[model samples]
Target: MECWDAAVSSLSLALMVLAVAYLLRQTRTPTRYGRYVPADIRCCSARLGWLVQEVPSFLLPLMLLLLTEPDTEQPGRTRRGTGRKLLVWTFMLHYFHRGRPVPLIIVLSAAIFCSINGFLQGHHLLHCAQFKDTWLTDARLAAGFLVFVLGLTINIHSDHILRSLRKPGETVYRIPHGGMFEFVSGANFFGEIIEWCGYAVAVWSLPAFAFFFFTVCSIGPRAYQHHRDYQQRFEDYPRSRKALIPFIL
Candidate 1:
């Protein structure tokens, strides 16, 4: 378990570094589906792609959570089974609603990546993480939970806003207004960033921290790319709004 944890942590850190490099290059990658889909790649139905990619996130954790037993005697393990269970459920809950249409390659890659992540997180929490039931009452936990909820709401609402921009047959892009879009160009990305940060704080585990770092590394660059694309595509795009964060880049 220790070896596995160490390997995952190392991989997460390496990915972060690669993400940083990606940001520095500023070359828009084809990973962003929908309006930004690459011209060369043959695409498939978005709904099917979403299911293929995101289902693992929901299922892998659930399976691990049900099958694994906790190690209470481990040095850093929290003694509260309830807290751990709640954390796992919280993690699973987020994945349950995450399906959205995307490119096939993107879905496949994400599915593969998330499968490993789900296993790492679920296995860690169920078998290795040591939290006490009393953790539920901790101020940190409460604050983090609130932040997580807030982020989730923002993420879902932002997606809705984006989706509503297009009518049934319309393919044109429109400026998204209302909600966090009024503040940040990548409101959904920002919300996801906050969500994972809150998760890291609430769980306070190496795996959780790794997951948070990975989220920032992966999504942060995409947000920047989206911001750049929007600015280039629309002459009247808002100049005041930042990319991933409101009023700050």
Candidate 2:
């Protein structure tokens, strides 16, 4: 294996291992954010916190693209390189759209996660991935892209359902209905998990796959917690619904 490949694979593997540890930790003690924020914890403006924590994931890839030049002397290699970079940038673009009151601890931890993931992904694109001209025509890529689009549609629709459950300035939580919510309490989480899984398939890179594993371990617990919380808080919550998946999880 090439040095970059070996390094990326090793790093990705390490991330996956850490993700397992994180999963165990989260299982024992759920993350303390959203509705579960601790009473005495420090807090930050959601807008500012989100911007700061999430920017690294966006900026690092951009810098990698701008500051580094491809092997332009080899025209085919240059095109492939640019393709990888574009895909990497696209992977992180969705993070630009979220903001709410967040715990300072959450912000700090998320910032670290974002920075590590941003560097791992961006650097992998810059140094490791190599695509041929026919990659665009691959059937698997097409299928993966379709899955990604589907997941994104589901995610967006589910978000709308959740948001609509509450009127403006309403602090009470209501059981979300419609869309994927009919089947899973964490329909939004389900969609996002599908989104990243599809992205992994599209890239067919170890780094991307590792990131998917990390995404699952990281957010999967949160989704289950959400499910349990809903069941406990609302006696009328749909009994048939699962946690992060439809019919199973």
lDDT of 2: 0.81
lDDT over C-alpha atoms for residue 18 of model 2: 88
Indicate the worst ten consecutive residues by lDDT in candidate 2.
Answer: 71-80
Clashing pairs in 2: none
Give per-residue CA lDDT, model 2, range 1-249, as digits (tens): 122666677889998998999999999998888788877888888788988888888988778767766544353543334456657766776676565678887898889888888887877777667677767778877777777778877888888888788887898999998889999988888888888888899888888899899889988999999999999999999999999988987
Q: Residue 9 in candidate 1 has what lDDT?
A: 69
For model 1, what is the C-alpha lDDT against the true structure? 0.77
lDDT of 1 by residue, 1-249 (tens): 332667656765765675566465545463566667767766666567767777787788888767665453646436436677788888887875644557677778888877877877777777655565466788998888778888899999999999899889887888899999988889999998889888888888777887888788777877887888899989999999889978878
* TM accuracy, model 2: 0.90
Candidate 2: segments with Cα more than 4 A from true spot:
1-3, 72-82
